[model samples]
Target: MKNFEIIANLLKEIWPEHHAKLTSEICQLSSDDAFLLDYIAEKIILIKKDKLKQAIKNYKQTCAVIVQEEIHFRRTQSYRLKTEQQADTEIYSNSSFMDMYLDGLLISQLFWSNHFKVFQFFCSSFLTQISKDDTLNRFVEIGPGHGLFLSEIVKKLPSRECLGYDISESSLRHTSQALQSLECAANVQLINKDIYNLPTDQNFDAIILSEVLEHLEAPQEILTKLSHHLTPKGLLFINVPVCSPAPDHIYLFKTPNEVQDMITSCGFRVNETRYFPMTGYSLERAIKSQATISVAAICQLST
Candidate 1:
């Protein structure tokens, strides 16, 4: 195939990863599709098909990091070191995926959770922050993946009504199945809907936004709108990736203070916040410290 044809095909398959350097290099290959393939194949090693499948699955499902080179030749973009890898799975690029075609990959890993402690802390702290009273009634958890945290809540406050919201139908299915297995399905309600325009007269006494804000387009707008869904004096428990490098994480809250400011700007009073850091290596590093995962809770005060 000609290089131009190859570029056209790549654009049709997946959205071009908006990296300026990569795009420029790809464009430079213009009508040399074979050369581009050879170029990529020479650069590509160890990364496999199953891994790429796994990486895409991981990314679409939960938090997955895409590691690549920060190549910049001062102002202009240049490609030297870059590879797309799944945080805990595999690595591949546009050419690699097409060589194998990713239609047969299963989408079941959306519920994968290897980091339970972080998820645990994220769940418990969020709910606790929102419930100022001894009792936490009428709580809503957005993006309740695997429903692991939902089970935790059922154990702590058995009488309270807990609702889990997610746009992914598969995720909702996992939530239902997991909660049903624990026999806590009765205490939770899972809904599949767009949260941005959720038409509900119902207001939650406590709202959970655990590590969800970063994946959004305008997180501020979402939080701003959520301000009203919370009942007066209602508590908003939120968890955000303070410095995690994930492809889907658009908003890199460099510090806990930045997150606090965003929440405060939304008219909430910050009560308490903590950072859970996690770090990763360049596949070359012997070990990468985990960046701090900041967990904080704010209250929608009644004036």
Candidate 2:
């Protein structure tokens, strides 16, 4: 808890009001997970301290866009972007901006209370599901953006070989540094390629597509393709946001059932689903108000 205390102090320096809530939430994490949070917090402070203020500003701007988009959605019952090309112009294709955007994302996970809930869910529920599956030997993560999730996997499942694919150079760099910083000895490969470019003949015992689905124009297509790479009994973990709009987020899922139904339609039988509402909101409130909620699921190939 000393490491968490140090992180809490640092967070207090940045955002005094959030100190108590951030400390309480972080304290709830398991020891190793709490340390990982502290590590990421320290990394942000060391490498991007000057940019932290800008990152917070950018996050607020993103929130503004989300609010605007929600109004548009209410009026038209449609997402603002219908294609990836439009989204590219909006965020992902811009390398410098994307780097800042990723940093802001890390900052949110560390200091923002609601975003912290998503992190906590992954650390506890998602990790628990993976740990129970002793047969898993090979693992792959698609769009392992900040690398925290994949680093946890490599640290916990040291005997399992791991591979990660990401289309963004910034994501790949962060993921590589995260894994190396953790001193993970597990055999690992980080490939900079779109999922379509990956070999079709290879399969994995576990596949993770966390926080990657809602950004695409065709999430279902990616899910279908990934289904082929998953072994018959392999585990698949996916995380998506409901009514969560960012500069890069294109597809809008309005409800958790929509996510569940989409995964089921893609030929995976969902084993577990966890929904974390945005801070200061209940699940029902989030759904009714079109507020942000993180929805994660674990699944297996349908028989």
Q: Highest TM-score among the candidates is held by which one?
A: 2
lDDT of 2 by residue, 170-260 (tens): 7787677656755662457999998877798989988988889988988999999999999987888888888776667778888899999
TM-scores vs. true structure, each candidate:
0.57, 0.82
Candidate 1 lDDT score at position 119: 49
TM-score of model 1 vs. true structure? 0.57
The lDDT, on a scale of 0 to 1, for candidate 2 is 0.75
Against the true structure, whose lDDT is highest?
2
Tell me the RMSD of model 1 versus the true structure.
15.7
lDDT of 1: 0.53
Q: Poorest 10 consecutive residues of model 2 by lDDT?
A: 1-10
lDDT of each residue in 1-303, candidate 1, tens digit only: 343343333333443452233345445333443343432222111122334334333333332212332212122232222221231123222334322222111111111111322444454456556444854478888877656556667866888889998765655665676577667899898888768866668688888787678656568888888887888757777777655444334455655678888888886777766544432222122113323344455456435
